[model samples]
Target: MADLNSLLDDLAAESAELEALVAPLPPEQWARPTPAAGWTIAHQIGHLTWTDEVATLAATDARTGSTDFTELLTEAAPRIATFVDDAAALAAGAPVPELLQRWQDGRAVLAEALRAVPADAKVAWFGPPMRPGSMATARLMETWAHGQDVADALGIRREPTDRLRAVAHIGVRTRDFAYAVRELPPPADEFRVELTAPSGAQWSWGPADAAQRISGSALDFCLLVTQRRHPDDLALQATGKQAMEWLTIAQAFAGPPGTGREAGVFS
Candidate 1:
């Protein structure tokens, strides 16, 4: 488990970075096509803001053992879908600066809620109870991944930071999340992952004696696992069938499988 203070700090920082990135875009650019087909920058940010709000409600409901979270989201999804559709429709007419400010404000509230949760406390996620630390990490990963789409569309490249460690951890731990989504049992043996961190330092996971090994730069590994970038685009080298298989379906999220942005969509 990650230290609560560190996780909170990372989430705060990631949220700020996302806000900064979106702040300067022109109104017309908000509705411009991104790498993710059928989504614009406004749509992407709206999704993040909506999910954060939902996660907070789910966490609150977990403490009370109330079904309010589930019921509310069930009823809210359609409304959110409509909002997303309407957001796209209004993007061209909306003031980009004001909309960006709204996104920043939404993220600030979400960050505050995440910081208030105890690290070890299990909160109701999409279907399972997840540690607050894990949830915070997931939020970072999603923000960074979606931010990548916006950055790509705008032809900007934000350098990776040590904060990316949180994102990488989620990517690695969710190996089981992926398996469960496929209704398969997680592999019993742990595979060794030796990744070069963005700061030029090396990070390793699992036992040294493990037969399977995944070696690559942290940025590439993060992008691959997040489905933000394809494995072929990176220099990741995986040895053994299980290691290779894991990469085939590395979903760090609980929802339905994302179609993933089309290949070379950014390039």
Candidate 2:
């Protein structure tokens, strides 16, 4: 497991990488549509900015022993399904320069806020409470996922990096939450997940001899869980019945199951 400081550093690096890709875009390109049907590059950056703001608020509240985040969640519960999209849409309306600066500032604030959280504290979030390290990992996952949208919009291909280790770890850890959101029961047995990282190192989880297994490139697994690509378009392999089913509905991020990309759309 990564310590909070290490995870925060990687989170910043991931954000910086994506920022480099977007920082130079001309105004017209910000309106380019991404793989997400109605969202453009602006929407992608807007979503990240909005999320970082919320995460910063949550972390700060946790640090101060305030109930602000809990109350915010309660207020949002009624609109949970539409709120994420609504927030993204609203943020996307800002001028490109303003949106970009907000994302830059918000993420920096979130990192600082997270670092100040007590080691034993659990911060409130959309899902379960998280330790500061886990919160940083979640932030890293969202940044990378949205970064893919921005990359796709610009027709730019990002090099996969070891930072993906954090994203894949979240993908595997959220297996049960994926099932729950679908109102389906998770499999009774643990499934083995093995992926070859970009550097060709093996990253494995669960019992080595588990009956159900998923194996492939770690990049593909991260893309699958983030719903950035259709499973049929990836190089993943699944053994056993439940494991195969999991490939179809896997989602690493919180919120409703996404309207996943159609197979061959990006093929």
Q: Write the per-residue lDDT of candidate 2 for residues 1-267, one digit (tens) a residue.
A: 689899999999999999999889897888899888788888888998998888888898889988888888899889988788889999999999999999999988998999999999998999888889999999999999999988887788899998999999999999999999999999999999999999989999999999999999999999999999999999999999999999999999888777788899778
What lDDT does candidate 2 reach at residue 251?
Answer: 93
Which one is best on TM-score?
Answer: 2
Task: Quote the positional error of residue 230 for candidate 2 in Å.
Answer: 0.7
- What would the TM-scores of all predictions be? 0.87, 0.97
Q: What are the Cα lDDT values of the candidates? A: 0.75, 0.92
lDDT value for model 2: 0.92
**How far is each candidate from the true structure, as Cα RMSD in Å?**
3.0, 1.1
Q: After superposition, how far is residue 51 of candidate 2 from its true place, in Å?
A: 0.5
Candidate 1 residue runs with Cα over 4 Å from true position: 63-66, 76-98, 262-267
TM-score of 2: 0.97
